[model samples]
Target: MEKSLLKQRLLELKYNNFQDLDVDELLPLMNAMLKYIGDTDPDLRDTLIYSSFSSLILEGRYSNENLRKLLVTSVSNDYLFYGIGRRQDDSVFKRSFSTLIIALILHVNIQKNFLSLVDMEEVADRLINYLEKEVDVRGLVDEKGWAHSIAHVADAMDELVNQKLLLESYRKKVMQTIINKMCYDDDYYLFEENERMVVPVISILRQGTNQFLLIEGIRQIAEDLREKYSSDEKSCLIYRYNFKQFLQSLYFHLEAIDLCEDIRREVKKALKVINQPYYAIT
Candidate 1:
């Protein structure tokens, strides 16, 4: 529990490049040291925790019951770790650790069908809440010159949908949220953060390659912009948004995903409408 001891253990576990810190060794330490794992205050032991969890999840070390309990309890107790319903920027360690945990859920647990002991529905709900409710506190850029909150949320959602961990209804809801956020161009700071979401949102849509969702998402965005433009007396401000570039990115990514013929045709039609004056809508 002591700061010095926590760091020492972490260094020991991290010794020889995690070669000696296998799952068999990690679960016990995590069980005894979960409270001391992350930074609650001056203790900068989060990196040690992050490194340990990263190894555990990435190395497919979910076979142990204690480890499963550790993950579940950590999420349940510390929403900040995963940014679930969290409005402020988490520590760097927490941000990256949250991402690792989500990746573990998507790849190791869901994909490999491991962790039958873990309540995945609860996990899914937490992830969904993270995407739906959490607020961004890390402004346009941190010292690193990029925001991790949106990117992490976007990446996590993309993985879930790609793995079919989320249902169609939930996927649609997430897509709508992403679209709305991206189209809110007036919030330039948040818009830049939303820009980090575009690729992953497109990646998620590419899973179905249906193009219907893409078309609808675009139409909804256009409608939103039209409403904004009209409300502002048809201001040229809407023209400054550069949604055409976004559509071009969508088109390129969808093509890379090898969209079906019908979907491809729909995409072409949508793009034509998107590029036209008044977006061919007014």
Candidate 2:
């Protein structure tokens, strides 16, 4: 297949709306590229076509004005739905989220309910797996990819939850595309540690600690201490400092009282001892 032929066709489809395109005219183009797209060298082919597809989607690829064109786009997915007899592989070489997004768009736009939860699960799992294991220690993605994995999971999960394929409660709570909170305290750090990744992970978890949990959790630690410390006159806003600081203050207050008592006792002894001897002369 000449590369320019597919490129030229995609270029035309890019500007044209997919909602209205007649599928009959679009089949030969897709049929011609089937082998290449479904290749073992997946990334090589996926990355090249996805760059154009991504640009088109962002540019109103399925807008109402292009409804006819969208029908043409559906033909490719229609082939996928009919089970194009091909070797299935779990490994993804190219733009991971791109295919999923296309499939999701096809599902929603083309109204294909036959596609089950597993299809989306595969995409979501790939996204999390890639971020957890594949992204660099720097949390950077390849320039060829988009940072839409997490966001895509949230989007697709939203659909599944609405469809009842996913439990409404099981899907991760998202706050503007980040994992927001979990109701259960049994799990923490749903993501693996990498500093760049931690910011989103931590910010999202903060919601898990409600006011009741904060007070109760602190109460448990406070009950184990030996001495209770309080000062009304000296300071108002002292922190609960180290135990050593509390112990030193306790001793200082005791020692000051002991010294005052001793001075009083000595004064009484001197007064009693000198009184009788001085009285006769006076």
Candidate 3:
């Protein structure tokens, strides 16, 4: 299937709200879409491939077996970890978009109960590893589209953390990984990345993560920001700014939720301290 032909077909499918399609016939089309998942063309990659995948998964168009395959492929090295170590490159589109697919699969699994505990744990582990290794923090490329690696993975983590089958240890690791990414030193997230990241934290809280673990995560963010504050380097300064925004976003999210008053208080205290000038001498 040529790219142009695929685009036209996907456009038609989208126009009809992805209904009445023969699942057997659409299999090849799905493969083609995955083939171009890394395409730099926003219309094809974002509008066509990604949107089509989301509609298909959310609409329950694919069989459980097919969804399982997608879940496997999305987390594999070819997609999730493709060109992973390289920074500020087009390769990010593949990795970032793959996370979206993984997130969608997990979202569907929440209701369908197709995935097993092992499947959930594997995804949880891979996502945390991806976050620790992912260096590209680009959100929206000027011409290509959104590379939002952190935010996309955060969405996947949000879904994963919501799964009751996932172990508490994995959940704790997810919480810690999210906090580490919030203090990412590469670049300041300007694309509401902080807010997107907040969703997983809230999910973790709602899913019954330990209050002590949550409080420790909050303190870790504060301590990381403090260390950055002590540095005069430009990168550290940017990290501080990003960390501040993340803390503020986190505080706002905490306020909206009814759970965890103690954790919310810790975040509030962290926010107050982060907001104060560095040179306060009384």
Could you tell me how far off, in angstroms, the CA of residue 182 lies in candidate 3 after the best superposition? 0.9
Model 2 TM-score (2 dp): 0.34
Best by lDDT: 3
Go through the candidates in order and give the clash count of each: 0, 14, 0
lDDT: the better of candidates 2 and 3: 3
The Cα error of candidate 3 at residue 178, in Å, is: 0.5
Candidate 1 vs candidate 3: the TM-score winner is 3
TM-score to native of every candidate shown? 0.67, 0.34, 0.94
Q: Candidate 3 lDDT (Cα, whole model)?
A: 0.85
List model 1 lDDT by residue over 1-282, tens digit each: 566776787777677666776546665665544554334432343356655666766676656454466556745536334444444444433543464456555655555654542355555566655545544535434333334555666666666556544556656666666665544333233344444566666666566645567667666665555455545542335332546455555566657776555545654665555445556544
**RMSD list, candidates in order:** 5.2, 22.8, 1.7
In model 1, which residue pairs have backbone atoms overlapping below 3 Å?
none
lDDT digits (tens) for residues 1-282 of candidate 2: 566666566556555644444546444544444434433332434554544444444444344334324323322333222232221222222223333444345345324343346644443344333333222111113543332333333343333333334322223422212211111112222222212222322222232322232223223323322112233322211222222232233234335444333323432332333232335532
Q: What's the CA RMSD of model 2 in angstroms?
A: 22.8
Question: What is the C-alpha lDDT profile of model 3 across 151-212, one tens digit per residue?
Answer: 89989988999886888888889888887777777777888889998899888877777868
Residue 51's lDDT in candidate 3: 92
Predicted structure with the largest TM-score when compared to the true one? 3
Q: In terms of TM-score, how similar is model 1 to the real structure? A: 0.67
